[model samples]
Target: MTVGFVGAGRIGEPMVERLLAAGHQVHVYARRADVLERLVAAGAKPVDEVRELATCDVVVSCLYSDAQVLEVLPAIVAELDGLLISHTTGRPGTLQRLGHAAIVEAPFSGTADAVRAGRLTVYLAGEPEQVATARWIISSYAGPVVATGGRGTAMRVKLINNLLLAAITQATLRGLAAGRAMGIDESVLLEALAVSSGGSTAARQMDARGGSENYLAAITPFLRKDLVACRDAAAEVGVDLSDLLAAAYDGPMNLGV
Candidate 1:
């Protein structure tokens, strides 16, 4: 399949490489031309604007947030006639708003390492036929393409996954901080925690290396976005997430998870 990508930041760049390796004719559009020079050399035709993705069989977006996705959809749907895959997580409503396009949500799970290793799992959501087409395109890089549900289901699932990720990462940070305060060897606490329910993919990652509290600050913005989405989703369904919201807000401030 001939694939085109919008956004060429951290995740986008690696995904472009994966698609290229799978022998797809890939094209990419980025606001910053310099950032994508290597991709251009690697056979990815780079375009200055999003509208240039008109000729692709599938156009994928790895945008930062829901609003950004909305901002770009007009260009995508107007110019491209094929499936539009949203690689951004937590933006179901945005997909539904793109009229006429066969929109699919295929959010990436796992780290950049997973992307590079082609071990990523993408949650596919859309009309059944479009989703099957997306699954075929996604198989070039991702391991399993599970159909989560139709329309916005993938985004909601992604938000829930982020909630757990934020909670666990915060908890892991506090555990390390507590160990640090008491002068206990970080490795000992990490090893012990890995044997308990507190252990997670994030916790094990931190344990594998001596972890620090400072790392949480770097990821604060991403976690904040997750909190906002979670709160909004809960409100939409008349569910209360006051405690979880409070915890999410307090986690970084208190250095407690």
Candidate 2:
């Protein structure tokens, strides 16, 4: 399928590469001209204007936030009768506001390398037909496409998943710090937890770090926003989210500007 992408940042760039590698014609738009060089060299057509992408079969956005998505909608609304799948992790509500377009929320799990290796897990939410098309496009590059629900539902699942991840990641970090302070081998404790009741997706991420930036970049404004969204979503449903909020703000300083 012909695919268009907006916001060719870290996540967006990798996604474009994978889509292009999968034999799909990709058109990309980014604010910075320099970022498009690799995509251009890799056979992607660089779209100078964002509205140009409206002509594609599907346009996936991995933008920084909900407001950014809103800002781009007017430019392409007339051109986007086709599906708009949002690869951005935390902006389901923003997608819902685009009533003129058939919006799909698809948040991916795992990194760019995993995506290149066809190992990323993508959760999709949208209209049934749009979702089917999205699955076809996503499967061309990802490991599995999980259809959680329609439109905002998929993003809600993503928000919930990230909430759990944030809490678990923070707990794991504090555990590691405590273990280190007490001189208990952090590696041993991690291994023990891996086989114990506390073992979880968060522990697995800790194990995956292997002393890399993967874990270090865990605490960021981006993550905090997602977790807070999860809290708000839960509150809307009458569920208390104090614990999650506490976990989110516990290491606020760790999330540097």
Q: Tell me the spans in candidate 1 whose CA falls farther than 4 Å from its real position.
A: 191-197, 208-210, 253-257
Model 2 RMSD to the real structure?
Answer: 2.8
For model 1, residues 1-257, the per-residue Cα lDDT tens digits are 78989977887788888888889999899777676888988889887678878689998888888888879867878877898988887645667776755888887676667788877878888899999888887776688667998877887787777777777776777777888899988778878876888678666666655554444444556667766777787788888877766655555334222
lDDT of the candidates, in the order given: 0.76, 0.76
Output the number of the TM-score-best candidate.
1
Return the TM-score for each candidate structure.
0.89, 0.87
Give per-model CA RMSD: 2.6, 2.8
- Residue pairs clashing, model 2: 126-151
In candidate 1, which residue pairs get closer than 3 Å at backbone N, Cα or C atoms, i.e. clash?
A: none
